[model samples]
Target chain A: MAHALTIHNLKAQIQDKPILNGINLEINSGEIHALMGPNGSGKSTLANVLMGSPEYTVTGGQITLDVQNLLEMQIHERAQAGIFLAFQYPVEIPGVTVGKFLKRALETKISGMNVSDYLKDLRTTMDFLEMDQDFINRYVNDGFSGGEKKRMEILQMLMLKPRFAILDETDSGLDIDALKIVARGVNRARGSGFGALIITHYQRLLDHIRPDFVHIMYNGKIITSGGEELVRQLEEKGYDWIKKEYNLIEEEAHEYSTN
Target chain B: MDDKGIVNTNKKSVLFDYQLNKTPKSSWSADIRKAAFQSYTQLSWPTPTDEQWRRTDITQVDIPGYNPFAIDGAHEIDVPDSVHALSLDNIMMRDTALFQSTAVPLIRKRVETATDIFEVYNLSFFNAGYFIYIPENATIQNEITIRYNFLGTHALASPHTIIIAGKNSSTDITIEHSINNNNVYIHGLTVFLHENAQCRVNIVQNISKASYFFSTGKVSLSSNAVLEYFEAHTGGSIAKTMLDAALDGSGSDAWLRGIYFGTGSQHFDLGTIQHHNANNAHSRSYYKGAASGTARTVYQGLIEVAEHAKKTDAYLTNKNLILGNTARSDSIPSLKIRNNDVRCSHGSTTGKLNKNQLFYLMSRGLSEKESEQILVQAFFEDVFSHVSGGTADKLRKIIREKISDV
Candidate 1:
């Protein structure tokens, strides 16, 4: 199977402090990859870099969506090029209705859909997500609850239907019912020609989505890659073992640098 | 004085006589005319040394030989289509008395009850304006629009409007002033709201580029009465407007919103007062101004909660957006609270547009110029929301058109 996204030797920094250090990963189509890491292990950093967030500087890296260079494009351009990022902390845009914003994004993406048919499609997606129809008319995430924000993100993803998506900690603060709903929504997008990078701290989300590959990220690098067993091991033991192992590797690198 | 100076002064007196002779006179018009001439003589034109006149240069306004024109019926008064666009009914101009018996008696009464300099001046030298009276317990659904257009050289136009909203009556009145010719114009408006009445007044001053405009409005609100006053100042070489309101009874409310946009060598000055004299009265004021080129604007707003007026709540704010290096704006908001239980606050902010907001909008596919226009429209949204009916939409269109030209 061909890969949908490829990140090679990605090294990123924030104000000269390394966050993502020479990380390499490839996500294939029709597959879900789980990126599990402890706190401050550059999990969110990698997601932001892939989404072309300006906060993180790419010191040395190459991120490609199929054959297109992702780094050369603007944020909205990246979004238009079929890269969707479900932010860990979504921004609130006041006075703009959710339906209007979704329609704008969709129009920018597809460029030719009729408004009435687009609205009908949106209503269908809202029904699938069990979202209140009134939410579509309300301001975009303005005064929305945490669960509503997460659900709205999923709703946008469904409306846009991007080829590659980065779900950055989408299950972090959701309730059990909300988590299940979110997992079900993600699984619905998991078939043919769709690829997702699910970045999370816990293995609970993996149980529902059942990723094809699990990767452990530490010190900005993917140290281990395996099947679902890696996620289970990280859930059982936590990231302490990986931290210890990376500390040894860092000591060895420092010794080599001094010599 | 020298012979040249005496000759010049005598010439001005002779000019005044000729102008007065050209005006038509009614039975009680002589008394009012005498009073106005006396008031104009007593109140001197504000000097540049005065704090209120510091920002507004009156050098060009010091024309000594320009005689005040009276309604001689020599010039045909053509009401512009823009005036009709306002769609105001029950309009009573200063001439409204000639046709209506009730309006004449009411004007006489208002002239008798007047005390302020502007009111006395208007009553004394008033030639024409609209006198709108919403009778007791009557509601006028349509807005009453009155237009005062000055169309000649050195035209001293004194137009007066007296609005009486009786108990339980409600109405909206829009007073629009425009000058097609380069001339001088002065006008005054006096409004009275009885117990439980509601009135919304929107005043627009769009004079000629080479004209001077001086306007004053006085309003009195009774128990449970409400007044929403809005003004848009966009023209004139020199313009000074004063709006004073007295909330005299319990449960009375007053809201004042204004916008002044100027360019070139224009000078605009505005003074507003919200006086709370009774308990439970509330007042709010928001005024925004934008200046470009060498245009200057001054906004002075006062909120006074009288003694023993308990539970009075008042707020006043003024914001200015300076678009040019030579453009300047002065905002002075004053609050006087006499009661211990009253709540009062005032704030003023002067700055250019936020670059971050512009960048954010531009990043979302809008051009930089388009982004600026959106931010400007958004900045005026809060002020526009207070405007109701088709007038608000019209004002929005006008603002958008003007911004695009910039």
Candidate 2:
């Protein structure tokens, strides 16, 4: 059976300042959606608020995964419910080896998983991602390059096999080669039981990882929704045409940037 | 009376009782004990005005309130034929005729350097004692293990351990101390490393929660000798230890590492000194500890280089983790370098758990408790990596137990 994630009339804020004015979206398994927006347009805010980030408060909203309430669940519970967020800045944990940390995480997520089977899967997934076998013994993100950190995030997503994933700017600092590797890792996990929300600033990433639907966000709200043609249009004319089409004032849009 | 149930008592009466009830050893041993007792009488307990006693308060600990001569337990000593492990009584009584020609002089010469009141008390009235000696040019293939298990309540016990490494010899040794019921335990240890010797010593102290513990040790190294010393302090209501090492020969190196975990209302005070008196000598000391549940811990470290010791290198580092709002820790690292061409540095850090780090782990589907357990264990990995495998596993088990109890 396919699971669906529904968000209706979502409003959120950080401290007293409002960030997400109102967001309405629905995603089901076996589909991928691309969310493109300029800087400070509440793209990242929506992703973080979906993951129950303590920094953001949900002023008014409703979010549900199937029959379970996502807003009422804790951050870790959301993760346990098959919601994964590939962070923009992966935190470094010193002295915690990648192999050990991932194994523990897998055990917690699937308490009855067979150790031998998990080990075999880990080996195969790492090989598929083109990660060195010795990389598992290295400390988690400690002294890792930017590309390595991003690859580690994808490796975790594949190992955990979440139902829905939110890729929050995972391609910002990657070169073309690394971008290809990351896209390959995500494509390997794409199937009937998987869904993804890819947040990006450029259409280059959308070229490799094709999306079924596209949405453009501005001023903390989704102003337009369309098919893949929207990505090409934005790449050609940039966000200025969208601003001009929406009749948005220049200073009013720039005000969110200062915040 | 304080929480430990200690009350004021006459110190003189307790000393006289111990002297009357003690068994007779060799004539020279008796003389040494008598001299130590005389010196102990002239000294007084450390007051809060003293620098070392400023953070820890012991005004209510009266040594005479408990039975000084009560002892109840046996020790397990495992060693190879290359090593000579003798009880202090066996060496001082049965082997008296050969005492002067034996290795007893190495202990006697070092024991005379004690000036602290607790050190003198341990020397004057030690109920449990052992002497370990590694002969010349014999590299023992097996490790030596010595364990002292005491199960007595409301008792005052003193234990002494002396180890000597002969010329060009090498060995690894572990000494463990534990108690079941409430008691006052004062311990003294001395080690001598002769020329071209290598020695590694690990000391583990895990006493009862209601007990009081005090320990003093000095390890001296000769020319081209190397020593690795590791200590773990995990138990006891009040624990204080003073461990010092001196590099008395050129080209010698000493690496000292220690870890401690305190819970409940326990208190711990740990001090170490790295003294360099020879040219081209190097030493490093790394100590880390964690405290929780209203507990308190302190680490005082010093690196001293003499004026004549040119090209001396030393480093000292201390890190502490406070597990709760009320738990506290203090770290003091100092360096005194007299030579102009020496490199020495010291650093100390104390902090709570990183919230970002915790959240990162939690986001991987682990609960708050599981995340904390992983992070706390990771915090001590750097220090544990330097220890032997079996000992490190055992220490990690103790830390895991402390975290689970929370």
Candidate 3:
């Protein structure tokens, strides 16, 4: 069976400096995967590349979503194709209301829904996220708090109803309560037809939104993959064990060459 | 060499002689011709040395040796549907059969409204125009739109328009200036809003690239009257405009907004002044311009609060967006506040697009061109939102086309 999202040997760089080096990953339908790594391990870079951010150039690779070539589509087209990214730092679009922006995005996606029906769906999503009705009238993330911003990201994901989503550090600066609310919103989005790849540096979020698999990234590459236990082990022992293991493998390879 | 010919035979003989030969002495147009001839000779064309014209060069304005076209039955005008969308019961369509049939009487009455020397001169020389009048306590629901189309080379066209809003009444008017072919265009207008009346005016100048166009508007406001004006200029080799409003009554208000976009070798100059004479009056002005290629733009705004005009409030702001290395813009915002206990301020800024904004939009799915268009539209949203009527939709389309061209 085909995967919902697939990245094959993706090599990307920023100003001649390789960031995502031969990275490969795939998420099947209804699967939630957590990608955890140390600082500068290219976790954010992977998410940005998947979203086709112009800031990072893909030197070589292929990213496909449900048999569609993701690399060839525009950012908005990728979004309309049911691929959504809950940015770590949501951008503020002034003079545009949250409700207005959501309606426009939904219209761009569906294109045939009338204003009344769109508003009805939006009100339902807002209620599901436990968001205040007043939030809809405010400018998109203009003066929203960190927690509010995170909730808004989830609100969009819920409203847009994308097939595949990449949540990049959604819990970075959130408090425990805010993190729980964000995880609840994400969990609500997960079902038999949805798939997600959550990028985080800590295992706290994993405690709330349990992942089907956990991937450990080191030096811009995924070195290990395991079940939920992997996150627990990495949280207790940290990435030092993974680094030593890779070092030992390198030493073994060097000795064999010398012999 | 007859006495009649010699009497006009001076260094400026060609000016009046040409006027007299082209117009009959007994005709109403002859009076306008003589007045314009005298004003043309008496008031020399504004020079670059003048303070108001310091930033704009008028040497290439094409002022000499052109006769005004006479309004005749042969001159057929096709009124676009968009122009009629702003029709009001009190406002007559300038090109309708009824207006065409009663053109002589309308012109006579419009000529009689001009008592000022310069206005009288314009009246005497005006050939084709429109007259609009609103009765007391009568409000117009739609905006009145007038379109002037010129279609020949070296042809001089001066279309005069007069608007009168009666006491406690309100209405909106839009005047569109367009040229189908290369030509010389000169136009003037006078508007009067009575006590407690309100009027909104939108002027769009989309002349031909090869044409030289000049327009002037003078407005008088009564007590508690309000005027909102917007001007959009995008074409012409050399376009000069002057808008002056006098707040003659207490509690009157005026708001002026303008936007100009120029490319190639186009030169656009805009001047505006708000004269406050009544107590507790208020005024605000905002003008912005975008110039690309070798184009140049100049904006001058003045807010004058009289000595006895206490409790007055006024503000003026001018901003420019420069797109190319050779494009230039000059902004001058001045305030002459003579009264105490009044609030007044003026500001001006000139800069290019924000790099961060461009990158932000591009990162979200839009190309560089699309990003620029969004930012430009966002910048002008405030001005366009204030515009009410079908004309707003048309103006939006025109701006969109211009953005795509860029």
Candidate 4:
């Protein structure tokens, strides 16, 4: 069966300041979409709001996972409904070992994951990620290097196998080798039943993963959507060409003045 | 006194003027009790104005309203034959000289110099007690457990426990305080570790929410002695404990860990002291707690290094988690260092559940309650790592119960 995550006229704010100004997008289970934007472009906010982060209030929006209303559900309920968000800065959980945390998460998701089978699956997944066997005993992301933290997030995504995943800058602070590892984790999860919205600022990550469609977001809204040529153009000319073409500087000034 | 050895007297009059009915006049404990009674008369119940009692108001404790329970009969306990685990009254009856030589002097000193009203009160009117002596150069493979269970209502259960670790000996002991509702469990304990002795002591206080519990104790370590002290306060409407570790000899080391989880209207006040009087002493203390449902938890710790104690290393860390909007936690860690060649530091953090951390867990498909429960369990993992065997299992069970209640 196929799943679709749809967002219609999504508008959100933090405290009283508006961030996501009517975000409209639709992602099917099979395709990978890359969301590119400059800093403070509401790309991350969109990802957070999709996962129902309490930090942001959705003043006007409707998010749905197939037939289920995502906005009406709690954060964890959305996750149980197969919506995963790979945090840009994953929070460190002290004293919780990777194996134990993953075991609990997998059990909560799958409900009937036997211990031996879970361990076997975990061992294989961790091996594919090149995580040391002892990594299972180590605390979750506590004192982990930047590259290692990114891999840990990808490791969780692979183990969870969510239907729709939003990678919020999962490629931000990674070297070439670490970047390849992350891309490999995501590629391994790609199939007719899995979809992802990869959010990043650079084209290097998209070069490795190869998104089918690219969307450029500026001033809290997607200004344009196109094919691989769009990513190539942005990589070559930067967001300035889009700003000039869309003529958004004067509108941005007015928006800031209203805020 | 009744035939059951229960004291029959006016509660208030007997609170001030108490007589020892079980012990002979010539017994060592009797003399100590008589001496403690004199000091008990000069003391009064702690008031809210007192600095230590300011956070926990005891003016409404109603100490005299509860009858003094006499648990002189057989207790529910099991131990090995090599260990000398006997009730204080039994020890005084069978071996009077042992009490006079070892425990009587210490009891006298604590009572005569007592500043807290509960300390002297426990000494003067204690109806139940125990004395465990680990022989010299002996290794006790099994853990020695002492269980004190209160069964009566409106009764004051005061018990004294004395543990003497002989030279070059090693052992682990657990003293549990379990009680019924509408009772007061006040206790005094002393542990003396001789030269080269290594001992681990676990004190678990789990009482009914309607009861009040108080514990006061001192642990003295001799040269080359090592002490691992673990305490868990997980019950009672109001619980207060004051335990001090005295490093009286060189090369002594003490590591202390404490944990408390409070719920409902429970209030817990825990006080700890690390006193280094000799050179080359090392001590570390870490205490963590969580509060929910309008509950409150307070941790007061002091690390004191004497003037003559050079090369003393001491550190203290306390962390608290408030699980409810109205829950509260207080952490006060202090240091009094007199020597210049010492290393000492202290830190404390009181906070609610980390929102980001919670969100991270919730994003992993755990419900809010399950996430908080896991976080609370992880919060005490460092301290919980120090204990093992039966005591650790019991602590984990209590933690699960407390977290589930929240």
Q: Pick by DockQ: which candidate is best? A: 4
lDDT of each: 0.74, 0.86, 0.75, 0.87
Strongest candidate by TM-score: 2
Q: What share of the true interface contacts does candidate 1 keep?
A: 0.04
Of the true interface contacts, what fraction does each candidate have?
0.04, 0.62, 0.12, 0.79
Cα lDDT tens digits, model 3, A1-259, are 3247999999999888888889889998799999998777788889888877878899998999978998998776777677778888887665456775576567666758799887887888888777899998887687899989999989888888878889999999999998998899889988877899999989999999999999988767899999999998898887777778667365533432343
User: Which digits, one per residue and each the tens of the lDDT, describe model 4 over residues B71-186?
Assistant: 33335556678877778767657766666687777777887788887888888888788888888999998888889887776778899889999999999888888888778889
Those runs of model 4 whose alpha carbons end farther than 4 Å from true positions after fitting are: A250-259, B1-19, B24-26, B70-81, B96-100, B337-341
Model 2 residue runs over 4 Å out of place are: B1-21, B96-103
Write one digit per residue (lDDT tens) for candidate 2, span B265-318.
Answer: 999999999999999999999999999999999999999999998999899999
- State the RMSD for candidate 4: 3.0
Model 1 complex DockQ against the native: 0.14
Interface RMSD of each: 4.3, 1.0, 3.7, 0.7
On residues B1-406, what C-alpha lDDT tens digit does candidate 1 reach at each position? 1124534566544544453554545434454555555555556566778776677767656544333452222222222332222111123213344224443454555555654444555555555666566777877776777666555555556667767778898777787777755666667777778999998988878777787778777788999999999998887888888888889889999999998877777788998999999999999989998887788899999998889889999999999988758989999888888879988999999998765444333334344565565556556766777777566667667666666766
Lowest lDDT block of 10, candidate 1 chain A = A250-259
Best-to-worst order by TM-score is 2, 4, 1, 3
Clashing pairs in 1: B32-B124, B88-B143, B88-B144, B88-B145, B92-B130, B92-B131, B93-B129, B93-B130, B94-B129
